[model samples]
Target: MRILLTLILLSGLAAARANGYDSLPAPAPAVQSVPAVQKMKITDLQDLIARSDHPLIINFWATFCAPCNKEIPYFQTTVDRYAGSGVELVLVSLDLPDYFPARIAAFAQSHAYTARLVWLNETDADYFCPKVDARWTGGIPCSLFINNKTHYRRFFDRQLTEPQVDLEIKEMLKPAP
Candidate 1:
């Protein structure tokens, strides 16, 4: 009986390995400054809005999305230029949970991403979409711009350019009309 139990466990482990479930996480770079990737829930996002005084840009992306990949460079450049403008950029990954730490970390490191990286932990689009925005139809490469001070917020459901985001930020920061 013990032998049979041991054999069953070994076969399960072998199956997991074959399915890439045993993949190792990417190693941290020698001079990494960005904070480690974190798992985020809807409540955490609410907390972010409540605590921040600056304009926040939260971008939703995934590893498999082509438009999401294309917009990354623009997002990176925008973050670099606005590093001191009280503008906060967050890259929220919608990648599979199984790709966490390993695939995601490697990609971030390779790109030398400067913004905060987060993995949206919810799998159900119906449960997560409403929490972000009632009109959000669960699209990849989406972005949300918010200024808690003025209660001004906007949502983009497609790829965005750097200048477009910059202009929006400039407008959002203007004295209320």
Candidate 2:
């Protein structure tokens, strides 16, 4: 009888441990916040391009890339210049998820950038990159100027200057009809 009781208690203990209920409490609900700058999923970007009448300028960058750093101020200036013109300037960081918050905050603080900043958090680069553009080649310092479905312009594998950015924004803002 003693042996039977011991075997029952042992099995109960094993079951409790397996179920992870021995000590730990239930997980807390995730706290969500409104992001100061909106992040985009692949679908969200695609939909924005489809639905918006305004021109969308997207700049892909990384925190560690030197050319990206140099060009960010130019992007910020472009955003400011185009303010209230129905144009959207989006800065998409390709930095890894672990470094995202700090890098984004630091960049925003340093440049005083008002343009929306987003960290691309999806891990499957091969799948997501082509969705943005098959010609992306997974390169930083790439910029795209899109005006509806009919007009899409992309600059891959290059850094941009303030004047160049301004010129592009001006070109995008020009009447297409």
Candidate 3:
């Protein structure tokens, strides 16, 4: 009888852990610095793109993705390089809603990333993936650069290097407007 009771308790514990009950505490709510660049739905982003006359760079990433974490510093550097410039660096985190705020806050605090970080809280990746970009295969570390109706550049399925980001930014900043 005791052995059976122990086995049941053990099974319950394992189930809880499997369900992420044993993970870190829930993340706090995110405080928005730039109200203009708040968490946006797909349609909202499309509208923003339509209205904005400057270049826009969007990075898709998640906390648990190793390559995503690795390239965060490079993204930060890119943001710093273009600070106060017409370019807008938007970071869209693919982390689930439950842990998104806390993880992103911690990440931003640690890395000192001043660019806007927004959570992509939509649960259906199948639906959201194509909305972001048809070329994206729902992969982390994907990026898109839109040059104010002149060009739309996308780098899907791989991490971006510093030079690569710099080159893209330079291309976007070319004198056409």
Candidate 4:
């Protein structure tokens, strides 16, 4: 009976420790505000794209994706470089709903990520995928660049390097023909 109770207790403790937020480092003071992770549907994203006045990059990523984690610093660097230029970089997280508003905020704060963070509260990939990109296979670390005023648009549904991100930003800023 003692051994069975010990095993059960250990399992419970393990589960409590693994509730999606324990692995992330503790938050730092760098992030002034732990903003609410806005839950966005496909329609909300469409409105964001349509109403953006300046160049915007909506980067779809998830906390569990290794490649997505790797690309964030590169994207953040470019975002900082374009500061005050109205070149916006929004990091749209595809993390499950369970991790929202707190765990995700802690992860971003720990990493000191300055880009705007939002949670894409979407479920069906078939519905939202084509709205972002026709070729999107629902793979993350993808980015969509858009400037509504210029009618400029571009999409990359793969891992992007820093130079590619920089160049993409520059491309978005160009006057459309």
lDDT, candidate 4, 1-177, per-residue tens = 223323433453365467763476665666477655677888998999988888899998766666777999999898778877788888898776777878778778767677888888876677778888888777666899898878989999889999998998888877878
Q: Per TM-score, what order, best first?
A: 4, 1, 3, 2
Report the lDDT tens digits of candidate 1 across residue range 45-150.
Answer: 7798778898888998765555776787787787667777777888898776776756776767766666788987776777777778887777667898888887
Can you list the residue pairs that collide in candidate 1?
none
Best by TM-score: 4
The digit string of per-residue lDDT tens for model 2 on 9-98 reads: 345446645776344233323562223545667777677657777778878776555677789887777767777877787788765565
Say which prediction, candidate 1 or candidate 3, comes out ahead on lDDT. 1
Off by over 4 Å in 1: 1-35
Query: Could you tally the backbone clashes for each prediction?
Result: 0, 0, 0, 0
lDDT of 3 by residue, 55-164 (tens): 88888766555677687788778767876667888777766565557656565555456677777656666666677677666656788787766655555557889898
Candidate 3 Cα lDDT to native:
0.66
* CA shift of 174, model 1, Å: 1.6
True-structure lDDT of candidate 1: 0.73
Which is superior by TM-score, 2 or 4?
Answer: 4
Work out how many backbone clashes candidate 3 has. 0
